[model samples]
Target: MPQWSEYTDGERIKILRGMETRQSDLAEMTGLSLQTIQQAEQGKRLTLRTLIRIADALGVDTSVVLGQQAPRRSMQRDDRAMVRDLSRTVHDTAAGLLDITDPPALEELREASKACWDTYWRGSYMEAGALARPLLEQAAARLHDQPADEQAEAWGLLADAYRLAAYVANLIGSRDLAYAAIGHAQHAAEQAADDVRRALVMSGRSWVYLRDTRLADALTLAERAATDIEPKFSTATMEQLVAYGSHVNFAAVVASRMEDKERAADYLSQSHATGARMGQEYRAHGTVFGPVSATTQAVGINVALGETGKALSLIGDIKPVHERVLSGAARNRYAMDKALAQADAKLWDASLETLEGALLAAPQWARHQVLPSVIVSRVATGSTTRLRRVVELIGTASSTGGFPPATPRNAL
Candidate 1:
């Protein structure tokens, strides 16, 4: 079989639509004309907006339709395995079927949960999934064995473990497992009776919705979560500020995706204010928020809204020290946004260089992101050699038949 990247954009759309979804059905679903759908499938006059609408209607990322990434059913073998193990762990633990004879102590489970989150933020998603299975089993076992007084902490740990599982599943394109894991996380959070944890679980669920192209649902839930944890700043603890800040920033993200510039700006202002009050980066409940995060995230928001000049300006405002403070995954994400802005502005060489550097810095994480491929596809005129190199880095080289070998997690 030919690699996905070998197909024309139109062919990809037709294949993704499958026999069950007629062109008229897709047209209605996307609120586009049937002629538009037919033209898009024939690789004629398919605008970016139309492509995004089609992809959303099809329940896949634009990268999948662009042939830069495979659809969920065609995910790589290792990705499938990781999702499989995570699915089993999520379901088995929720059903009380795990036979964990010797669960780790509560403190040990807490530390393990932190380690799993650390691995995930480091962009070692496969490793994170591997770590999450045992963490979930151990946390569930501890929850079952702990007495009433200690049960809350165990439940909290289990919620954290499930959050990690959800994150991994979402990134790996296992949407069903992502929803299941986050549902279990929310249940555990509720059992713990921790308002902040519940709010964070809502934030996680909103993220799943965002990736699933349920924009309105994502925006609603993010706004609600932010409101639930809104801090007074005068007396609020660091945890409250971080949680609230993360939610507002995520709201900005969802709002931007929806092209609601006014609402996006409003949420961004709140995020910036929350970050300013916090004074520095704070990580809690598996989320990060701070001045650096707020600013870096804004670059992408602006880029999404077609404000390339604003995005470039924001990128310029980022200090070297601030950039250094971001995690591997966060840093790569920022790089992709910067490269995208540069591409939009026709700074082809700079865009390619930025993309190349990011891909080398964290190939594992870069592969999971759609932005790298999006950036490459937008650069229509560049040094063929350099463009080819960027293509190879993103694993879309037709010569390779598919993506390159997976980068070892330890390399990052």
Candidate 2:
């Protein structure tokens, strides 16, 4: 696992600042000397109760910081993976120690968490989410500390891990785990300050709601994230900051699913405008977004706006070869978008061809392709018998809220 030394300077600085602010505020609230506060902020000395006191003053949930190693396209061989893993473990341990109350347990958690982080970073998002969750829980239960600050931080880290776990589990069709993971994120959000970190917990919740097809709740949470609660954050600032674009795009997708085309278009326009002002390149950064969210937002809004043509054109412009590596997921997603775009244009043959190719490439996630497939089938076959088969295929594969219930209004 990675050690504390493995962390970037920026990460160290962020942790330091959080600790310092927490300390000084505690001192002022308790009428302690500024020198004492300054000394603690500088890591000169701190007592168990002092840490606990500051934790209370700062409203820190626990010592665990919600951090992730940088995303990589691919991990190295076993030897290299082992080295990176060590670094991650060490780094998480140091970060955990900043707020841990029990010295020995904190050390153990640090070591364990570092390994967890490394393992998580070592695989694809699908694999990482699955592997990291149980370990996160194991570490959480094993670590015991006294200081309130340490207690809060440790709990917070556990919550962060669960949130990640839940998101990935939900994506992969694990409902029970997703629910539990959401519980963890919610738990973390409660003790978090009005920071990007806190907002992310909310963001995680939004994803859960989306996966469940609970559009109203998801929209509510997403809109909350888009708000300016974090005063220093700009609308365009990506860093850990929440962007209105994500909310807009998410809302757009929900609207599109509901077949509320006008509403979807409105949301799409708003998202597009937000994305524009946010800058495509900047939005792609971990600051505003990463691959999934960034591309998802762009693709979703455009598709909803009935401008899939334009959206596919933009996707093509991106050249899809990220760092000379053609990510299978990205490629599949691109094809899916193209198929949908063709479907929108009423080019059934082209849509069918593209979708068939996508299904062959990655069959599991082709659930989203079901609707277009149904439409294409309907267009190609006038017989209601074949159309029903096609719809059944779609219903079985779709993650949508049970075939949209087949309302009379939509039937028309």
Candidate 3:
């Protein structure tokens, strides 16, 4: 049996499309000609634009179609279980199904919510999900028990918990649960009437849309959120700056995914300007944005736009002092983009080395990401031993082994 990485681009597309979706169906979905769809499945003249459209129509990330990622159904059993448990917690709490007589005080819930966000940024998503289960239940119970005077704070805490839950679900490929959690988070934010929190919730939803391949919706929501909270740079509060910067940065992300280089560049410029005004990285309302973040994220945005040289150039701009402020997940994401850029530049050995270092530094987080495998599969020439080590760390060799077969679906 060949590995998924061994499949050609066309074969991978066919597999992802499955028997349920005929070529004509795909053609209609992608707005491409039948000839184009047939050529795509035959490994003939498949352009990037066509590939993006097909991947979008298939409802999976481009990496999955490129064989860099197994479909979500190939997710590890433990990860599936974690998402299931998280989903149950999110739904049960929303329905007021939990039985809790002694809810913690607002301060305690605040601390726990902060801890969950911290865990998530540290790239310990599973641990964060575990923490969120109890936190959501408790936050919901606390919201119910709080007096009228204190209810706003309680609602804010609950919104934060739901945002955390949404993050975990989005990263782990539970799209429906991610949507549900964010929807609940938005409602809670509205209840609290915190403009900053409400804007941040919109940002979170944009992320979920991005991951789910609703690029237009994601870009629109992010742009709207940023516009709504656009603060006066001369006197904006730090919280306001962070919220605005995060949304614009995310809009840049979604635009890049849409391959709208012009819009992406504009958003990236706004993000960098905002970050410079802030002068430092600040994490708040479950989002991070600042000088370090703007610079680090540009590396990925450039790569997505096929500007590998530009991406590689930005890597040098990230000074060691600034890099030190990035979260573990943020750091690894930068490394992945850097490696991809290196591979695109034909520096195969350097790409493999960069990927190996990230895998060694954050093996668990690496396992959950598709980019490591994408980098490994793209490197045409490198130390075989080093490449295998990176592959092993990302668990691509066993991507489907020991897991029950997933039912074939027409779309993700």
Candidate 4:
């Protein structure tokens, strides 16, 4: 057996295809052209979707083709169980969680929502989502029982619970689950009649679009949602300010991904203005948006736009206030973006340091993110020791016992 990284993609595909399966058969099964199959086996360029299709046709995980660790059998079973549990929670009725005549107090609902948000921000996604399911059931059931004046708040709480589920699923790379969760949020927001909460749900929808590579739709929705939530800074509450700023920042991210640097900059500028109005870091409606967050997100937007110099310049401007303000996940993501800028500039050592530091700060979050893996792959050829360390931290480094998957140097 050879180290997974040592073999070319074509060789791995050939081995995976084996003697029993022919290229024509694989092409037919995967709905890919015979030529495409041949090209892939010859180590030609293939899109991620195409690779995934091929991997699935072979009855294997994408990791099998990418030369990464195949998930353990136990992990696979757990994932299946989670999916089942989520489905049941989403479809099942809340029959006995609360009395129809005497619902839980509004304050209790608010506290439960707040606690769930805290759990998510603290990076306890699994726990938070588990908590959210029951909260949602109770909230949904209680929405009809609330007085006319309090019904909106009840709906808002339900929306938040659904958003929690969607956010957690998105973070974990479960797009289908995320879509289901977002749908529930959208319906709940409609009932709530809350512009800010509706905008928040739109933000989640944009993430699902991004995951599917629908950049145009993602940008359009995010921009429209941001516009819809734009408040008069002079009178807007802190919560409104946070949601507005966060939505605008998210629009900037979508713009950058769509390669519209000017649009991205415009959105980012608007976010900065909103943050200026807020004055300090504020987490509201499950979003972190303030001066620090705008600056931090700006770094990533600049990197995505290929403005390495500007990205680096922004990094230098990050103040001590930022360290105390941003969430651990946000800080780590910013560090990863800085590392990307360094790598693009060929400052390999600085890139490695930034990358390593981020992994150390939030190992679990970093491991689940695709960015760290992408960055490490870029720098891996130069420093074997650093590569190994990153691989260890991520827990998916190539093993000698498994076959290598096709990994183009510029895949990310």
Candidate 5:
């Protein structure tokens, strides 16, 4: 099979412009013409190897083009780089695990994060701190010894990494860890008073809150951060693009969580406006702004809030938007919301169907914890089996938590 490197510049350019271009985007920093880059993507008649030049120019390792790496260039990617690469791998792996909704992918992703964490430590932990508490912690240490003037950049990286970690952790039933990291990110960003860092920490964690409509602290912080950062960041820098879009999406999700349908709709409209402003898409890089419809978030919120008919109507309007790069786990999370909405409608059949789909979509990621805490109050004694599975999964992830299915079905 022809590798991406073998493609002419044209084909490479096409992929570069895709949603999965975390690495490819860096390639464009080479100052090459669009036609030449496009030709390199297609492996057409070009004596000049733009991909290599592109990679070199951007200070990135070429393997990022092949999907084996996340970013091609590293600012100081040693252990920090390892942690980041592993964290992203962990995020995507968790998603894959969730999509399978089984132990295999969950086990695999869990193991991968563990392995990377171990490798990262042996390579750099002693140099940074006594332990590898989380990726965010490591990122923060880089700033501790730096001069006050030079520490802002490190702080920004720390805040972003922590928020990203928290977002991923919450999806995998690691809520406490998620919150902890976000808190650390919040503190670090505040200390730095860095607009980009503060914006990232707030908006990133808020994205998780948007899921349950519970992470409002995240959105609130993001909005404030956006306001602070707006004057500091020009439209030319990617930071402005990221910070602005984050607030738009945060507002949409926060409104949904609050059950203010009108507000959610308005915020989503604002988010789309910002989306149009982005020169390129992140390729499912739901990190900045996402495909999350106000309708989808609202439907889930209404279901959680006991407005079943409203939830159903909103869900019906959802356009079946799915992302290729958002991670299987995150996708499964959306499915869980859909199921919960069905359950609220007392469409027991619909609810059961939704649950079944959620199971099939993310058996492992769907552990008992994913169920709404409020569901327990609404559901009868007979439906506890489904609840038990979720409980057991949470226990597994917990350094302190597990559940014994009341009826002991070996579903795994």
Candidate 6:
């Protein structure tokens, strides 16, 4: 038998989906849309949750599907495999532990849940996804056994876990998983009757919409979420500050994506105001928000608006001191935005340099993201050492096949 790792994900799926099981069968069993199954079979990206669903439906260990790591054609391709394998392990393990009648110790559960956030912020999506499943399952089980007095607290924790799962799923390109997870989070938050958590769930939903390119829905949801949590910066707790600021920033990003510069700028101004109140970057509810994050995100927004000079200026204003404090994912995203700015300025070498740094910082995440592919497509065709290294890291010119064209200099 050929090693599963030797084949691309689509090929592996085809192999597993023998004559006995049709694509429709897998889709039905996994609770995934036929489109998702088809995409996976066509070698398009599938999220961790989707991969887990498929593996479980097929009744095989995830390792059977993933096999040992092999050379992938591109970073995007590699990420699809990594997330799929991790998702399988998480779901399979969680399924087996579902019969436990007793709740886990609260402190242990808290620590485990915290670890998931830390892992994700550090840009280890597979590790975070693995941790999230147990945290979500165990906390959800607590809802059945915990005392009535502790029910609200249990629900709150479960909501957080669900929200974390949603975030993890989103990171792994599990669109449907993200949707379901956020829905659960919202329900749990409602059960907990926590206003703050409810608002956070709304923001999470907005994030899902953003990922799906539902820009109008994302903007509307984000605005509503921000309004729900608009605390007075002076008297608000750090957590409140972060949540409100993050929601507003998300609204700004959505507006930018929609090419509504006026609305985007308005949202950015609000975000800046919130950031000024916070005075520094603050993280809460698995989101990081403040002056630095706002400024960094704004660079991308400006780039989206085709204001490359403004984006470059924003890049210049950011100090190394602030850069060092960004999480690995944030740092890489900022680098890609900077590279986009450079590419627009026709500084191809500088753009490549920025992308090289980003690839090294978070290679796994980089491989799955479109930004790296976009940068590579726009770079000069000549083969320099840096270009060759980027090709090695991200795959060939063909890896970006069928991707939308580069944003024109005057697209906005």
Per-model TM against the reference = 0.80, 0.52, 0.79, 0.75, 0.48, 0.76
Prediction 3 global C-alpha lDDT:
0.83
**Candidate 6 per-residue C-alpha lDDT over 1-412 given as tens digits, one digit per residue, 9 for 90 to 100:** 3444667777767665655567898899889999999998888877889888886775444654565433222223224444455455335433444555776877777777777788888877766776776677688677767888888878888888888878877765566668877887898899999888999999899988888877788889999999988897668998998888888888888888899999988988988888888888877767788889889988998998888999999999999898888887788789989998988888889998888888876776664466776777888643499888987777533233212122222211
Clashes of 3: 0
Tens digits of per-residue lDDT, candidate 1, 357-403, equal 98888866766666777788889888888898988776642212123
Can you give the lDDT of residue 308 in candidate 6?
90
Candidate 3 Cα errors over 4 Å, as ranges = 1-78, 396-401, 404-412
Considering only N, C-alpha and C atoms within 3 Å, which residue pairs clash in candidate 1? Answer: none
Poorest 10 consecutive residues by lDDT, candidate 6: 403-412
Clashes of 1: 0
Q: Name the better of 2 and 6 by lDDT.
A: 6
lDDT of 5 by residue, 1-412 (tens): 4443454444433444444343345445666676666556665644446656665543335564443443221112232233344444334432322222212222333343344334322222222211223433344444544578876656555555555556544443334556666676677678767756666676656755554445556557556655655532234354465566556656655665566777666666655555555544342112433334323444555554457787678667655543333335445555667767765655544555555555555443433332533343344433456556644443442211111212111110
Off by over 4 Å in 4: 1-80, 93-103, 147-149, 380-383, 396-412
Clashing pairs in 3: none
Please say which candidate is ahead in TM-score: 4 or 6: 6
lDDT of 2 at 184: 56
lDDT of each: 0.84, 0.49, 0.83, 0.75, 0.48, 0.75
Query: What lDDT score is found at residue 242 in candidate 3?
Result: 90
Task: Tell me the TM-score of model 4.
Answer: 0.75
**Residue 84 Cα positional deviation in candidate 4, in Å, after optimal superposition:** 2.8
Error of 6 at 122 (Å): 1.0
For residue 217, model 3's alpha carbon misses the true position, in angstroms, by 1.0
Q: What TM-score, to 2 decimals, does candidate 6 have? A: 0.76
Name every residue pair that clashes in candidate 4.
65-405, 67-405
